[model samples]
Target: NKVSGSNAYVKSCRRDGVTRWSDGNTVSGCDGGEAFVCNSQMPWAINDQLAYGFAAASIPGLTEQQRCCACYKLDFTSGPVVGKSIIVQVVNSGPDVNPNQFDLQIPGGGVGIRNACSSQWNAPSDGWGQRYGGVSSRQDCYSLPAAIRDGCLFRFDWFKGADNPTMVYSKVTCPAELVARTECSRSD
Candidate 1:
């Protein structure tokens, strides 16, 4: 019971229907099962800060019991974002795995500001790759700022807390520096 899900209420974000896109957008409780895809720009760009987006519908069973979700760490496991880290939040709990849309919290820092575009598209093939190529009904991710282009693709780990410090999520990677990085409210 004490996974430490956020006390903040979980509410459904506006249903853009693959129309959700933008930076600093606040989304929650979206049943829409749109997904986050990998994006990129050439590396070696000095200013790397792309505000990626994502949203998810909670596991219907898990939603009632879970209070909040904390996106503690991010990994550019797939595309240009490999080896990079950024900030994010769980915008929605869904019907399934994919989210509706995400409000990237950071700006001009890691992945800069990704302007409002479209969420509909094929999955990313480069970073983690995907079921489809980079075809989207949305705007071009490359059209975003120079920062996001640098390190584009990433997979985020949303976690609460474990009942035991010794335990961990079955789906999440086992340890730190191996796959995804980690952070806690205590550190904040």
Candidate 2:
């Protein structure tokens, strides 16, 4: 299935061991009480023109269970990353996500509605930057844990610091690399 729109933006979620519906267990480095965003959910560049990443999406008509682990090929139509494509696997979802939004899970990207980074990584209450848009520069990536710093840098480098680029998206097969990270596959 495919959907085209101008409302999409690659919002960032904070990194921590969060209990996501797709993966029932908490990722390492956080107490078991709350599930934070997994560090492995971070996005990475496959090449200058392409990338592979994970996102927590809200697609109208699909429940979280239906969306989890599903892959989408996003062809950017605007902003610095216009024309570049990224294949992202849906690993998380939330009620706050507006319809058609894919919140890319970048480490230094803002924590959105959650703040487990303070408990898991000792980050500030609002995370590395503004609560909604995260770290302003590549240098801020250094503040993230080593395991996820590369993903933060990816936003500044491969992603070209594009602020919420709009994209045309379609459902696609999940890549093995992404499946290996989330250990999830949609039954549908």
Candidate 3:
């Protein structure tokens, strides 16, 4: 969806807080009222180990089932966030979010940790080692990470405004060793 870099911001998901959804239930897309470790685990946590991810209000045309485990690669183009990019997954839905806007996890979103999210995997300061913003900017959208063809791991591709985006997103899947403990389903 070619999210103008200016439109993206940073947000973290935690297993705590009354208003927050459990990581176990969040990712399962519980259409049948069944939770699948969606809110119980963090994207970075392996059976309580720390992990990372981001959130969004709504994607272009994906159903709730399609949103879970969805990934997007954000490349910042301006401000203190220039020349940096990180991959994030869809862990929570933000009804209040504007179109083309994203709420990135503090760790992977480049935002310094602030104890706002779960600290299962690592310290708050360990968040993506940086932070972006809540302002409007420009960023290029791609389904696959840079230099995908040069790697051995499976690659998943996506567009900024794709229709009915799938769960097989590039960044959503936890590595094989980590998946047994976390909720992120394996795409491969």
Candidate 4:
């Protein structure tokens, strides 16, 4: 289930609750899914079921499906993480983040410490957070977290432009060969 995609650096980050007039805050899962929406005019919301493994936003066009819920297989090219690959879920988009860069979900991505997120949020009980600027990576992705694997159901209300909404995400598992090559496990 390998797909062709470009390479990029991945950074760990947190999920925040937001409002139209003010950037609110939340330590728990997104308040009814609209929390990740950048635009108030949009009627859709991103279900934060996979908050731990999800990917934050980055510059557009890095990959055809870099948008919400887009999953990528990030193969580390150097550092202690070399030879390890992890699947990431795309959750947020950042304007300041340059292209070909992916902001991973902190400790959940197993790259850096997990501090940008609050304890009430997805931080693990050990209480460590990533302070590193970035983690190196090559291109690649699957597998759902406990919440989704526990029978979470989704209902997508389609619109004119969403002719390909479902396929936006790649739900394949990491190749057995890749998992066997390293001892690294997906944090969270």
Candidate 5:
């Protein structure tokens, strides 16, 4: 077991008063932005070994500016949305929505309306029912929303049953593969 300060920076990252991610303030960026190494005896610390990644996506028609960065810690798929489908960027407001209800905001100050009727993950009486088994829809929904309104979000491809949209993602990556067919297309 080793102590900290072995090339470690002491810092924290927070959004809307809740910490999202963090590191020491002395640097511009992380050399490997995924997992960090604390002392082996550090309680509740994440493991160090990983294959990290960072990416961003912008929904053009929806006018959202989300500079998303994700780390592929354990062979997790990289996609338009690293954690959820309706990724969007808004001005100022973040993580402090009333009712503690999660909401997605588009660039034009438009609030995303969840198609509760059509949304695959939500049910009025789901003590155990879920598309991907979570308190919310993040664990479900294989499609990433580019445009959302009128009881439906414009997601080009959606997979049924499986948590990951491998087929759809593969199809979407096809064009990009043409740019470098011999290599794996980096998902962003």
Candidate 6:
């Protein structure tokens, strides 16, 4: 599918093996039927021009099971992140996600839809900022949990605070580092 404007956001992780449910049901590691984004799933830089991360996406013609652990290379074409690329592994699915859209898992990127950060990290009710978009500046990142603060900082430092940059994507082999983090691998 032709995907663009694949926005990135954070949704705390539960456990390594538990599959994310798009309906926002409680998985392992989170209490009260909340889904939490894992800190390990946070995007990290490989260099100035490249990086690796995880995301929740809806790829047309693919089942949620099929999208799990599948990796895609995104060639950003707009915003401050233009010309940069990031390899993202699908670890979750969003009910609100549109066809061919990916919601990247970036700390401090904002917890859209469901939120477990408050329960998981004692964060504010709406996370560090608005539920849909998140903290506006690097200084605002301090509001996030200390465990994920660096991941939040990544948005401003390595990512240049790019906002939902548009991009073209293609399937690629999952990187060893990403596989190690999610403990998932695609057979096909």
Model 5 is weakest, by summed lDDT over 10 consecutive residues, at 37-46
lDDT of 4 by residue, 27-124 (tens): 21233332332211112222222212334556445543334434565554544434434455554454344565665443222323333223324434
- Positional deviation of 7 in candidate 5, in angstroms? 21
TM-score of each candidate structure, all chains considered together: 0.30, 0.82, 0.38, 0.33, 0.16, 0.83
Model 4 / residue 18 / CA error / Å = 17
Could you tell me which residue pairs clash in candidate 6? Answer: 11-37, 12-36, 12-37, 12-38, 13-36, 13-37, 13-38
Q: Can you write out model 2's per-residue Cα lDDT over 1-188, one digit (the tens) per residue?
A: 11122112122223434333333443322343444556667798888898999887999898776777789999999999998999998866754578999988788888888666778788898989988899999998998888779999999999988888999899998888887666666545
Shift of residue 115 alpha carbon in model 5, Å: 15
Q: What would the per-residue lDDT of candidate 3 be over residues 1-188, giving only the tens digit for each residue?
A: 11122122112133321123333333321232222222322223222212233455366676545555556655545443344344556555655544555554321233222323223333234322223331111122121123211110111121221122223223344333333323354232
Best by TM-score: 6
Q: Give the clashing pairs for model 5.
A: 11-23, 13-22
Q: Give the TM-score of candidate 3.
A: 0.38
Please report how far candidate 2 places residue 22 from its true position, in Å: 13
Alpha-carbon lDDT, every model: 0.28, 0.76, 0.34, 0.31, 0.22, 0.76
- TM-score-best of 4 and 6: 6
Better model by TM-score: candidate 1 vs candidate 4: 4
Residue 62 CA error for candidate 2 (Å)? 0.9
Model 5 has an lDDT value of: 0.22
Task: Tell me the tens digit of each residue's lDDT in model 6 across 130-188.
Answer: 88889999999887767788888988988899988899999999898987776567767
| Per-residue lDDT over 1-188 for candidate 5, one digit per residue giving the tens place of the 0 to 100 score | 11121222222222111232343442211222222211110111122221111112222232122111111112323454233232111111222333212222211112222122122222233222232232223232222222221111112122111233221111122222122211122234
Model 6: how far residue 5 lies from native, Å = 27
lDDT (Cα, tens digit) per residue for candidate 1, span 113-184:
221223322212221121222212123435434444333322121211111112111122222221121121
Which clashing pairs does model 2 show? 17-36, 18-35, 18-36, 19-35
